[model samples]
Target: MVTVNEAKQKIIANTEVLTSMSMKPSESLNYVLFQDVRASISLPSFRQSSMDGYAVHDSDITARGTVLEILAEAKAGEGTMQVLPPGAAMRIFTGAPVPEGATAVIMQERTTRTGSFVTIEDFPVTPGRNIRSIGQQIMKGSIALPQNILLTAGAIGFLSGLNVEEVSVYRKPKIGLLVTGDELVQNGSSIRHGQVYESNSLMLRAALQQEGVTDVEVLYAKDDLRATIDALDELAGRNDIVLASGGISVGDYDFVGEALQSIRAETIFYKVRQKPGKPLLFARRKQTLFFALPGNPASSLVCYYEYVLPAIRKMSGRSDYFLRSVSMPIERGYSFDGERDEFLKATANQDVVIPLDGQESFALRSFAIANAIIYLTVNQNKVEAGDHVEVHLLPA
Candidate 1:
């Protein structure tokens, strides 16, 4: 069995970023940019008003009570082609184009209007006040967003402000999930003796979706060699990553490892020296990567977070593929007698982490409330109450 870090390195070495595709900026959320995005046009292409006020030349405001003739009204989206004459002002709304020769905007609330003339009441009248100049945000033909930036809502909005409708980004990998076990039943179905409600698929799918992986296909396979083989065969050709749950351990019904061999997939590693998911299997065939996770809900989810999520992030061209880790004090002491490294589910804040109960492979109740996973190395089995520990923070 390989160490967790070694297994992670192997998985990363085998994974490659997928091809890039041109998609609308709105549809490119969470995707990494393949190329630098340049602004087609300058943001605020023209001098714009930033408030509901009167646009005027600074020279026209001689004093606080200076009165100027109102030329015309300029509202948002309407062009004001006429230039402002000396001692003149234009009634302008927010986002309206500032007229030529205008130096400042006196907010309407600071002025009193009588007929075609308005008196400025504010004491200070500064030039360029309440105005957004051309290219203030982004200059035309300039790089608006650098390559490899993950497109978030703010990035999309900024790109949109630059008049960019589409962006070139690395495509997310297509994933196929095969859940194997005859004792597993779907939620809402009647359960008989020896039957368990299948939740790994649902949990894994939700986790994948949180990473912006939506092109996922899930299929069920009974605890039979032929059935598992068929499922693997079908998904291997159709997906870039195939994740199967259960049937990899040395049990009578465990056939996932055998099925991979039957299909001639190369096993990168069959197990990791970690608790809860010691029987994890990772393999590959050509461009397709495979992971056979333990069947227990907590074990499956833990393996997915530790291994599969990073692989997906790498394939999507992310620079930071692993979960955020930090060192914090443990609220209480804990002990493990085994040699394998353990990931204990815990609730954590900025200062400390509290290891929760129910650390068994099949237990997920504690995992549901856990915000972090405390990592305990095999070299040390016991921890003091206030000892500092490394914690992997779960995605919110």
Candidate 2:
């Protein structure tokens, strides 16, 4: 068995960022940019009016109540390249291009209009007032967004404004999940004696979806070694990552480890010195990564959050892939002397964290309400009421 740190390092050393693909910026939300995105053209490529007012030169408005003749009207999206005659004003609306020699746009509310003329009010009109200058937002041929930034909705709109059609971004990975155990029965089915409703598949699928991974393939396998081997082989052949829940521990019915070996997959690590998920397994077959979690629902989920999720994040081009952990005081005293490290499901605030009851490997009630996982190291098991401890915050 390897230490938790060693296991994590091994996973990191083996994982690589996936290849980049060209996708439309609108469809690239949550995907990390593989390269810097440069602006194709300067935003607002022309002098634009920012208000529904008159476009005029500095001399057009010499004093309050100065009346100027309206040469022509310019609406949004219409050309206004014609020069404004001397001492004349052009009726302009928001987003309309400004005519040549026009230095300012007086808002309509601050002016009174007569027949074919507008009278400037007492409001001071300065040069370039209410005008959007060319390239006001972004300059042409400059880097609009840096590499490795996650694209949000606002970023997508910004890219569209810059006329960027497609972007190079790291693609999300395709995952394959294989659930094992014959004692487990599907939900909505008749439960016979000694049979329990299966929930790991749905739980794991929802977890994967939360990470923006939707292209998942799911399969079920019995305790038979051959069935397990076949299911794993099929999943590994079609996915970038393969996950198997159950049949990892050394038991008469456990066959996940044997099946992986039978397929000639390289075992990166067999177990970690941790409670609830000590029998976790990580391996690789060619380019596809594999993880076999314990059959217990809570242990399976804990392993997924700690190990599998990080691997997915790395593969999807995230640099900060590990869970966010911080040290905080415990709300109450707790004592445990187990040889393996323990991860207790807990709810945490900014000041302190409270470890919830029902932390057993199969319990899920506490995990359901947990927002954080309080990590207790193997050797340092005793914790005082106010002692600071490491807490890993779960993604909301």
My TM-score estimates for the predictions, one after another, are 0.95, 0.88
Candidate 1, superposed: residue stretches over 4 Å from native? 122-124
Give the clash total for candidate 2: 0
Clashing pairs in 1: none
- Tens digit of lDDT per residue, candidate 1, span 1-396? 999999999999999889999999989889999999988899889999999999998877878899888989888989447588877899999999998889999899999999999999976678999999999988999999999999999999898777687899999999999999999989999999999999898899999999999999999998889999999999998999999999889999999999999999999998999998999999999999999999988899889999999999999999899999999999988888877999999999877899999999999999989999988888867899899999999999
Clashing pairs in 2: none
- The TM-score, computed over Cα atoms with residue i paired to residue i, of candidate 2 is 0.88
Best-fitting candidate, scored by lDDT: 1
Q: Please tell me which predicted candidate would have the highest TM-score against the true structure.
A: 1
lDDT of each: 0.92, 0.91
RMSD of 1: 1.8
